[model samples]
Target chain A: MHGMINKSIEDLVTIQFGADKWEAVKKKAGVTETAFVSNQSYPDAMTYGLVGAATEVLGLTADQVLYAFGEFWVTHTAFKGYGDMLMSAGRTIGEFLDYLPLFHTRVALIFPNLKPPRFECSDRHENGITLHYFSDRPGLSMVVVGMLNGISKLYKTPAVVTHTKFKDKGADHDEFLVNWGAADQK
Target chain B: MTDSAPMLDHGQFSKLFPFHFIVDADMRVIDTGSVLARVCPKIVPGALINDHFLLFRLASEPIKAFNRDFIARQENTLFVFKSTSTDLMLRCQVLILRDPERYLFLGSPWVRNPTELKALHLVLQDFALHDSTVDLLQLVQATSTSLHDAKQLSEKLEQRVADRTAELSMANAELSRVMRSKDDFLSAMSHELRTPLNAILGLSESLAEGVYGDMNTKQVKSINTIAESGHHLLALINDLLDIAKIGAGKMELELTKANVEDLCQASLRFVMEQAQKQKINLKLVMDNQSVMLTADERRLKQILVNLLSNAVKFTPNGGSVTLETKCDLESESLMFSVRDTGIGIATEDLKRLFSPFTQLDSKLSRQYAGTGLGLTLVMKLVELHGGSVAVESEIGKGSCFTVRIPCKGLDTLNQHNPSGTISLTEITPAETLPSNTPLILVADDNEINLMTVTDYLRANKLRVIQARDGLEAVKMVREHIPSLVLMDIQMPLMDGLDAIAHLRADDKHTDMPIIALTSRAMVGDRERCIAVGANDYLSKPVNMKQLVKTIRAHLPNDETL
Candidate 1:
């Protein structure tokens, strides 16, 4: 994890809720630094702790908080400087999701120590797809839910999501079912 | 989950598993659960798992030998299946019970959606409503669409930036072209104006010196005035060319050791008469015996002369102008200061004093008449020497202009001339030795330039043959085979450069001295003339002394004797 990730999370909390919420979240996370450096790398424990603390401070379920943060990462983080990179990778939400494995590899250029997840997309159809999610760490599959919602918003393509299998429920990997509708006209 | 596989399972199991079966050690389906019996009523207990069902991951193998959780080196890995009677495929989880030595398989139908299960020859009420695969499918679809939009936006922005950059560079190129045109215009004007001035000044000299006829006192003085006025205009024109050369970084210098004292005293002589007329007291102050540096003597003299003349022009009647020199041993610098006690410049004007073409009192009726380029030339010249000039003045008290240049002596910083072989100083209008002088052929298109040079050479008692064009000159040179040929570069028929090339190529006149005369003083013109086979080269408005000396230097010694 990097301080930029923490800063982005802080920014999301502050902007979506309020400055007071961010202050409480930061306090609960036990972060001593008032401000995180944008480029400095920090321990992975710090980022995971912050996410957990954010859920507690905001009085939201862990799924809701992680899912909201995942959506925020796309709308905000990708826009920071990686919009061109993301754009070059994919033109549609389906294609972009299919390219997630490659995207993480490219993201590793910027974050050298990133422990990125592996994504495998299969059984693609006109309306929906089966997405295979693999990661070394476990128990935050709900964040993928939020990320899917954010991506649909980015593309103006509304979609419904269902968890096919849960890593928490002793499945080998988390799998998701995605069904898409026509893109929004606007 | 994978790191803790292969515990011989018996206590923990799902009793309500769909399509449960037990396979004995001999690959035989010994017993079947009630649900399996309900699903397949005619199927007996002897039906093998592989014979009855086809696994999508792997078909159930004949259970011959089981070792290390892999029966016959193959594992189901939760194989998916479809019943022989129904179109539904079940996701089967297998448990090999090693203690009882039985195989238990639990099967549940794979459902991508609740609606998808209705067409699979099964009732909608037969299975549960909850399925997570549908949500996972939606996540992948949305991510791809967003990236495509971003790609489109980025490409558009990149194209816009490229277009803007191209426009800026094209505009920059046009501006550079305009600047070059302006520079060329100034250079051409300098050369064009000076060519005619050379004839005017030279003709005036011949008249004043009684070359054509005798002159009375008033006529002589009038001619003198005209000549002096012509020289002043010529100096201003030369300054235009010199500054242009400096700006283009084409100015070259010839270095020799020059005495600072001698340079100052000699420069003082040029302004002595003017100072006397103004009743200004001129003085020289020296700090030591020797003040010397490696420099171009004539250019250094020109600098000293410009400073002395400025000092004299500004000083009032009975005011003093002093030239001071100091050899600073501590810094190894030669410092020259020109101090004047006339009307010192205001503090505000001092900042812009050396700017080109700027006269503080710009009115026509100002006390000093000048082009206001003298100080600019001085500043540029000092900079060329790797030095600096500064001024200190108080209004109406006095002004001291100081020049400090490093004392490099004679060891370094000698400049090489990119022009022809001969030096300007070495050419001093050869003292007319009288031994039937050399037979010289002069070629030029300008009648006035031709008349001026011919008369000057005739006065020195040299036998001269004239040609109006390069063709005529070439014919004359071949016919007369004169001791020397003075060729003008730009001519009406076959230019001087071409004629020189022709003359040098022939076997007859291979060693003949051909001196190039050009009115255009642009850089590389001299080099072009010499490269084309002229023995030496000269620039127009011809300095009569220099022209005569160049001719004499290249002429054979036998011709002079």
Candidate 2:
């Protein structure tokens, strides 16, 4: 994996908690990298370990940490060029959900080694839809729901996102039910 | 085909070269893409290329005309263009074709963001969805993220370093606290252990001396054994503490000029009574008529005592123990050696002779009763004075322990003293005991030390008064104004130091002799005692005989009294 993923994890944890808490997480993870280059390649296990260790250090469950990281990833780090690209994908939360597959395909072309999860938006409507997510990696299904929530908030159309199915539960892949619009408004 | 028609493959061109335009040698656009004409409004079939756009790199180079050579050289450099109408940046690959003498501009919009495409009125569908634009945009984003991460990591690392530094300082403070507590424990332990031993030996000696009334031979023998064993235990404790202080480099050697002849006779006379009781002969040999060395008199006497006692103990009833002294002007040192003819030590046992807490044949057998510290203490004392001690022994022949005192590098000098030299073959006190009875003050908090000291003074025919603590001692001194004071240190209410301070403060008693009796044989105990106005220092289990001698030496010789 590129260092961008690992660096994203660090940025998210530090912003949410504090520098001390992030240090505790890194220590728990047994990570030795004092500095990380954004474009340098790193082992995938480092990022995974950071997420797992952050769960323990921050007194949060594994899924909760991943979800929080998912929300933080968009607001804190994915700005400037990537931010504009995401904004241009769709004008509304429903449109963005419909366009998630094409956006990720474009991203995979830029990052050749990236194993982006394949997204499928089915039963799409103005108010609600089921977002199908298939990935070679396990876990992080809750992260997809969190990312959707963040995107909905970015578009100012708050959505209630819940994991409808999981690969760990013997389903073929993970799925999330995302509902938004005036009826789903908080 | 028409002359102004685009001369490129029609089928493959639309998909791959959808953004290209053909220009002739005159720099006029001969033909342009259908998509380009919509996206870029200035592009027409006959419009001049430079009139609508500016090339970023070639504008600064020395070139009047652009050609295939220029295009080939500029291939590594991305040829970026700014549109005059739309303000959009363009990057193109220039291909010079020979068939129609035209430059094929195969390029795409170079915007890193999608919203910028909106400014040009173009959508994702307009560019055939090529992956190049996507890769470029992602590359720009990654660079920005890397810089942000570096800054964040720097700040966090600084915070972590600060936390660690604070922890280290706390640990250092804790270590200092522990060391201070350990020193206090040693001081307290010194008094706690030796006080009881003082009582055991003092009472037993009093019993054996008939002060408490004597008994038959069996009872006398039992009392003697207790006193002897108690003294032995006291010696071991003193040696162990002295060794610890010397190892720590805390022992103060009070350097003074000592006469060679005096030191030799003192060594011989130290063991005179024991040698005589065993019917062993003692002799002294001197290489110089008179010599003086800068040394600690008290510590030098201690080394001599260990040597003389060991010699007397090893020499048989019919044998002799000889002490030899020499002043080596070449080496600038004074030498003292003790030779004894009795049961000589074996070669293997001699190797470990100076190691403390070790006994060879004496360990299992009861023939010899000793703490095995005498020689060890002697070696350490000599080394503290920057000297060396060695031994030579032959089984069945005898053993000889020789110590050389080096005179160097300290506040010490070797000199030849003619007046102080008086070689006496006999072991006797040069000055007779005080002829008249003198009033002496015995001050100590421990009852045993008080009784023992007063008894010794009384037995010497000197009138004695007792003060159990420093306060009473000072009060008695002011009232009766005794001729001399024997002060025991480490007392309750007021220590010997504070009491001496009080007594010395008075003008009339300024010259009065005060001797400090301390059981804490730590390195600086004597120096502390003397600094407070003590005339001399004594250590416990108090030596009654030495106590009497010290009193006589301090009191006026009837002329002043």
- RMSDs, each prediction? 17.2, 13.0
Interface RMSD of each: 16.2, 4.0
Evaluate candidate 2 and give its CAPRI docking class based on DockQ: acceptable
Report residue A145 deviation for candidate 2 (angstroms): 1.9
Writing each residue's lDDT as its tens digit, candidate 2 over B252-355 gives 99876666566566556557668879998887777653556678866887798788888888777989888787666677777788889977888888879888
The weakest ten consecutive residues by lDDT in model 1 chain B span B416-425
Q: What is the DockQ of each candidate?
A: 0.03, 0.24
Candidate 2 lDDT tens digits, A1-186:
557566767888787789898889889889988867666678778888998888888889988887877776666556432676666556567776787887677667666776677898898876988989998877877677767867876787877887888799999999888888575332
lDDT of 1 at B201: 82
True contacts kept of each: 0.00, 0.45
Best by TM-score: 2
